[model samples]
Target chain A: MRRIHILCVEDEPEVLEAVVRDLAPFEEVFPIEATATADEARRVVRDVILPRGELGLAICDHILPGEDGVSFMVHLHAQEATRATRKVLLTAQAGLQATIVAVNQAALSHYLAKPWNPDELVAVTRRLLTDYVLETQTNLYPFLSLLEADRLTERIRSGPLPGDE
Target chain B: MSIPIRPLDRIREALQSIPEAQSEVRDFVTGDVLLREGDNPGTISLIIRGEIELLKHAEDGDEYPLGTLRPGQLLGLLSLSSGNASFFTARAASEGTLLTMPDDRFVELLHNRIDFHQVVTPLLLGNLVDRYRRVVRLHLEVAELTRDLNAEKRQLQAAIDELEETRNRLVQQEKMATLGQLTAGIAHEINNPIASLSRAADLLHPQWHKVFGEGIERGLTPMFRQAFELGVTREPLQTEIQRQRTAELARLFPDLPRPLVRTLAQVNPESFAELRSAMQRVPESVRLSLLSQWAATFEAGVLVRNVRVAAERIGGIVGSLKSYSRQDKADEDAVDLRQGINDTLVLFGYVLKKFILVVDLPELPPVRCRPGEINQVWTNLILNACEAMGDTGTLWVCCGVRPPDQVWVRIQDSGPGVPRELREKIFESHFTTKQIACARGSGLGLGLAIARGIVEKHGGRITVSDAPEGGAIFTIFLPTGAAPD
Candidate 1:
């Protein structure tokens, strides 16, 4: 069974650390990764995470140093490997046009502004990850407790698990 | 006044009856000068066929056409009657025939023939009356023309005054706009850092007490002390490795809280393993308490760093602002054009997020100039380029020193290029390509005009042309030597 992962890309170190700390509760069930740049995030996606894990969610800040987060998210959406990764734009300065592109082209699922509420962020993450896992992953036991338990229970009872005879 | 034959026609008939008068008739083409001012021609010529021009010469030798003489009109009459030199020059304005009667014959005909006196008296009196009427008409025409010219001059002067007032108002408006931009930029720059500093300060107090309060009450072992210190020095984690390490820590400490596991992942791997080994020796509660302390200390360090970094950024922004406005420097200084460009870019850093900026600046010699004014030149060009490109295009700014004591800066963008016909007109004052809303609100049109003014004041030239990579390119050339005041 492939592990599901949540990724965060933020340029500011303090912000990145705060986001990672907020999402620490999901560390056991779904691994969470944080990178400070879009380039580093791309390398981690390509070289390390994709081999053993499916990227379930990506919460990205729009303003970054070299290549901005919107372009990176669009790139991710284009690739088959990470195409289904649920995208969220977490930014303070993404203008109207950039936000529109993120929504239309990058398939952005949510927009969380800066100074976000920790509980809301965790809830959104849980819901997105649950939606992704339910659609793709065959083994839903690990995520059952962290996600919407009632919904997972219904899915489990409605159909046999994949590879079951 | 009511003679059956006109007086001048009657005189011509009498003169033609004389046999000797036939020999006096002569034909002239156009432009023939029959009489010159100040010359005593000693003859009075009658225009028998076409027209002649009576011209008055000025002191400066310029000719003013007094009036025209048609057939039956006489020329040289003024000098002949006055017995002085002619005051008007007569020229054949078209193909014409004239009968010239010598002054002696003219006088003899008057003295010899009784009938001639009858014709001559009225002829002379009629000519005098005609001259007086022409002079009166000329005076009226001159008065009318002078009145019209005075009215036109007043209208022109009023227009010039209105234009001057408009120019002054625009200058004030532009200054206010620049001031507003600077204030907004400074406020934005200061706002971010202050927010970060406040947030960090707020978080530090509660977290700081949590770490030491729990650890001291629970009792800190020597190994716990060492682990806490080691954790404080831990390097920040790379994304991929941190993921692997978190999972590894979770597996080893299965009963540990997830936060502890995550915090432990940020620690040095060698120290983390030693801390884990030491943790096995302690009771579970004690171990958890010690790990919690480590996490708190680690967070405190991050908060402190954030505060320091934010403060430093604020300071940097203030420094850029000071340099950009030349607040602390003299009005004229030896300036690096590259620095001015960079500082202007810093002021626009917030707006430049949507643009891919390419800066190519080689080392340039210092130019003596008013640094603040030069910075305004850069600001206008860069802002215009950004506005032109809108969002998501490349902006190129290049600067270099040209030979013969001149430096040049070129700002170009990848957007719809300026139309060829509008290139010259764009620099005109109050001219703009943007829609009315943006132009009116932002003082949009005055930017390029002011830029041109500053450049010209510095003994330089600015020009616009098509960029090589398809957009508008504005280039400014300034003298490297001292700029004139």
Candidate 2:
């Protein structure tokens, strides 16, 4: 069975660690993966995460060593495999123009600035991941505790999880 | 008081005996067209009064007013002499008088009769001289107008170029300000957290050793210390390298938990032999029992040291940024050029990450300067070098104080350089060999020109030459005495 994974792409290992730690609550159901640069992130997506599962969400820093986060997200949006993966831009330096490009071209799901509140980061991750699972996944029980439980529970009560057409 | 000014008296006396000529003149109104261009004027008519306007009709059907003709001017004599057709249209500018005579007989009188010739020749010569002088004056006026227009056009273009340069400076100024301000803001925001994080690590390290024998084995203290130190210092390995290491470690300790083996792979060896010998004491059954506690201690060290190192990195960046961007500093302040250069390097960390910067700035006397502007000069030259190198190459930056009152800085890059012929042309404003990098067009083209402007303003001279490393070398020399007012 393919699992859903959360991908965190940030050049700073310290920031990546902090972000991964915040996403610890969902790690049981949504495995977390980390990479430092766009090149490494793509490799991880292709070789590690995608081979084992679907990428549920991607939280990327706006600036990296090469191939900026917005352009990388735009590339992901262009591809069929990752088009529906939820995206969040985590940056301290993305200007208005870059943010607009992320929004217009990459369909960025959220924006989290530097020195982010851990709880808020977790909440945003939960919402995006829950949104991803509800739209694409049929199994709701695995995410009942870590995700937006009310919405998932309500969804479960309202109808059965949709099966293949 | 006659409405028609009679023809010149000489012309009347001469024509009195001429059979084919009319001595009586005709009076005409302002609206009369004396003769259309290209028409045959059968008689020579003199402008006897008021004025006549000479018009050259254009193909566009618009008449170009050449000039006006006054009384005593011969209208058709020149045309008759040349051919028989009028070359230009002559219209009555104001009410005037005219006279007519047969063209051939008028020519015969002027040629055959000496008295008539003497009388009419002066009038003809006088008119000819006046028309010649007018044409010469018109040419001079046209030439003067053209010269004036060209001078104004050059001035206008110069003004536009100056405006573009001024705008570039302002944008550069704004960019520096924003970078400075952003750095300050980041420092303000992160300083406390960083301070507290480092302090917390400092507080925890000692406290952990106190709980020594409770959960931790006192005999295993050396091994624990080594593991903690290893975690604090080791850099994360590449994925491929880490995987190989993990596989090797698993082969060595086949019975150890996979998690413990993986963790050992990360601590990469200053004391791997010691760890292996120490691990020999633990029975294979209890090794799994010790894994969780050992892993916890190792992780604590890594996380704590990561915070400490990251905190130090943040402090360095903030300090560099503050030094680089104190735009409010007075122009008279004396500063170490090296400090500014280092700060600029810090600010350019993103672009210069892959660059190998060989800085040889030694101790030198403080030079009076605008620190921000001086750093901008550094930024421009460095950026130029970076662009020349196409983002990856070695850059050499150094400064020296001459024994006299001069200080100099040299920036060199290891990239394809400016050709010898183009060295001088590169200093010129708007002279660029690069394609514009962005829409705002900042930094790519205007850099060197503005850099020269700033250096010149500081009473400095800048020059470029070929570097020994097959790249370009830019040198700036400045007065060490005082900042230029």
Candidate 3:
């Protein structure tokens, strides 16, 4: 029965308002927090707001002002701490390239899209939170340390690095 | 002009005696590699019996069948003009005989001797012209066949893409439906709590009233006690509290009747001055009740609105989907090219809204056409024009009546013109300038070809040429008066 803190980042104001209003009725839910700029978002994630174990999850906008959601998540993944929170990148741009990169690189949970139904938003959040809580409750560790040495080999074959040949 | 000449039989006998001319007499066996394509530089083969097949070598070293050489036909004459190495391999087919004559001897026989040149040079030139025309015709025929194949490929791909789009749309729809059902269930689940909240608000309204009335009664009784102690009447203060409570309660519960009017006037009449002091707090109590009721009402309103919207939205969405999913089943009849173009352009209104569309369609009689297919053609062309413009640019469509009774339509866009290298094969299968991800879409190179096929089927032709304004121009000419009225 613990409250989950969600950080949402988006560009458009109307869509943000709709999301806030839709989720307002949940008394158990805190005021849905949002940010516009990816830089501000990164700062929120690192230094000011989230810190270590403050924020539970993040739903980021794929297309943003400076750094897109994928690149931003890459930065988050690089951080030593506070990288374990579940991440979902919401996008309107079709195709799975950005989604795949963001998910695989950052070990993200799922992707959601714009004009999405409110129920879907809740369901995705619930599922993601459940996984996070399960891992934490059971004291399970999930990391990609074993695959780091073989990164270059995989990149030459399939990763997004240039000079693939 | 007067000269003595040998008889035809003597000339034939003399020519037959030569070794080079002897092959004109026998049948060549199968698998006989008669003459390597470049073996004799300008040797001509005269087929006397059986057949000789001409084969051009494909880049993969495979021999591609060209045309066959029949009896009494001469081959290799084209080599005279094309001194470059022969581009094909020649094989003796089915026991055929070919007389291979040296280039120099054949030239001499036709030029040096006046009688020989007069009799033979004209025949050679005539044969050369015929061969030239045949090659030209073959090239055109091959081009047409290629165009047909490209069109078929595009249509097949379009059907596949449409099916995929439908599948995706259906999946999205199903997800939406499931979401809607879940929403309804949630709304129903939450409704009970909202009703309980309203009931609690109702029960607290009466208790809140007593608290205000009792407080006013105590305060007023004290004031009266003090007044009596000082020997003064308390009627003025008592009347004041009664008036204040009525106005405050009306304002607090705007939707409901004033609570003080019913409670103070009918139920409690003891110590009117004391009751007035207690009624002062009645306004604040009623305000609290109103706030609780408002919250409960707001929640119920949202639940009902959300479910209603989900149901209504699903119907509108399914309607749009039904229209988009029907392939090859669109209504067909005589359609105005202009109207069809406009209708097709509707799908790309977002694209056109950013650009200036200049249409110069000459007013003319409507043409009998396949409405849906023609609409697709116009849609593809217009969409292409919009894409070429990228974010913003100009698009021009010119239509008029061409000579010999044909309707001509041309669409032009101000984008980087088609590259010269790509112009020839732009209508070829799977050819596209769009990135594979955003390729519009699965079969882009096929659009023009499909358009060309539909136009041609209706006895028309479609062509692409450089636009006057330095962009690509697509021209469609449809034969007028369908099937002779």
Candidate 4:
């Protein structure tokens, strides 16, 4: 059985270290470039990461120096290899519109507001990956009679379901 | 306004014998021009016996009237700086005796006349230092003024953007509300007809099949009964019937009474008991099928209710946003600080969804203020508190009224508190503590500055302190202007 590979993109050196350290213990964690500018990040992904294989997840920093993190995720979605990567945006800002736009357009797996705890991040990412596994398994057999498995697509697309209560 | 001038005969008598003294006397009337600042660049005039008023006129037509001069003080050093213009123009306020010296002679006396220079140089230097200090202070004030203006401009722009967002939200909400109203109305209208159709279908469906089944059974029942009655009647007929029956029996012999008959009757029974059992199956099967359909109908009802609820939610959200937007600039209404805090919590329901907000708000009377701007105070502080904790931590909001009618609102969080060094400057706009997107926080720093401005505008204050739970706490105090007449 193949496990999902996560690509963590962060701009801050300390934070990048923390993310890698947190995820390395549980899963196959791949660290992308911790660049000062968004251009450098884009170059690193294009020139280096895409050649590896399909990415299962992309953890993006929302505030980067040259270009914003949300735009970068949109770019990632445009790429064939990384389009399926589950996206999570990390931000410290308090306003709502930016968060709404990220969730709406980026189809993010999660939004981890800063300053986030390491343990909390690990828990959330782990849950998301588990959910991804269930989804993949459900999609493999399209002819199955089980509506429960088939309904995952709708549940994910609709965001948080009302029955989540 | 007019005071008599004293004669300085004593000073001249004291300095007359000095060999370096070069002095000339002049007479001045009231309101005479004693010294045109730039005209006599090096001449020092001694006020002998009257009052003098010095004036400085700028190019922009602004005149500065310097204070009155006394008998002992010397003038003309206002132009001493090589690159500076005369500080002001001077004029005699009353008729007076004056002692004057030429520019070159004044210079010579400063070099040779030790006693004269000693008394004069220290006074001049002191005045120069004072003027220099004022100029430096003015420059600093100008820089600060520039920064403040820029901040205000940014604030106004943010407010305008917020206004636009609120307007768009309102319009969208109104449309949604109208659309929802239409959907409900249409649903109500169509439900009656659809229900009637379903009831009619239900009434006809079972009866139509029953009628079809009974007609076929009735036709078969008479034929069987007629045959049984014919076989049972008269002796001769019975013998003939017996022969015929024997032939019939030969055709339908022992196989009919065999186990297959019982099994066939059990599987597809033809007796009255079997017929009743078969008839019962129709209603049971129909009920089961109808139950599945009813489940679907029930789900649809739930969906419609959900839609109604959603439309109402949108309406409620837009209503609050409209209030938040308009309240921002409305007149300074009397505000209950505690109530304002509660409203802020409601306004930031989105944020609270991700974070746990705990309130320890005090019960107090209204604090006179602009509720709209003060609401911004709670918003910024509370948001900052949540952001500091990354929106998943515990937040504590406390409010109370102090003596002399000052109200305070404090919001604390469970994330890392502010560092000691940065506490003072955190309220400065654009400051953030997050690691990623320091410039943007990646977007959390806008609220604190806005909050500070609002509090100050209300003649109140805001500050950040350490929370009891080891995070950061923001405290705000609002001064109630006055009680109603």
DockQ of each candidate, alpha-carbon based: 0.16, 0.09, 0.04, 0.02
Candidate 4 lDDT (Cα, 0 to 1): 0.58
Q: What TM-score does structure 1 among the candidates reach?
A: 0.56
Q: How close to the true structure is residue B296 of candidate 1, measured as C-alpha lDDT?
A: 67
Query: Please, what are the lDDT tens digits per residue for candidate 3 over residues B237-289?
Result: 22224335544555654554332231222222344344345445557756445
Sort by TM-score, top down from the best: 2, 1, 3, 4
Q: Scored by CA lDDT, what does every candidate get?
A: 0.78, 0.79, 0.57, 0.58
State TM-scores per candidate.
Answer: 0.56, 0.67, 0.37, 0.36
**lDDT per residue as tens, model 1, B349-410:** 86675578899999988887887778888888888887887656889999887886898999
lDDT of 4 by residue, B10-88 (tens): 4565445554666777888998887676674476776668888878787998778756776656667555445355667
Predicted model with the maximum TM-score = 2
Computed on C-alpha atoms, the DockQ of candidate 3 is 0.04
Specify the poorest-scoring 10-residue window by lDDT in model 3 chain B: B228-237
Per-residue CA lDDT of model 1 for A1-165, tens digit only, reads 578888899977668888988898887777777888788899888876799888999999988866789989999999998899999999988877788889999999999998899999999998888889888977777888889888788888888766779
Candidate structures ordered by DockQ, highest first: 1, 2, 3, 4
Model 4's chain A TM-score stands at 0.68
Judged by whole-model lDDT over C-alpha atoms, candidate 1 comes out at 0.78
Model 2 off-target regions past 4 Å?
A70-85, A95-110, A131-141, A148-165, B1-8, B14-45, B48-68, B74-133, B148-311, B326-335, B354-370, B386-422, B432-445, B457-460, B465-473, B477-485
* lDDT ranking of the models: 2, 1, 4, 3
* Backbone N/Cα/C clashes per model: 0, 0, 6, 3
Candidate 1 lDDT for residue B234:
49
Candidate number with the higher DockQ (2 or 3): 2
Among the numbered candidates, top lDDT falls to: 2
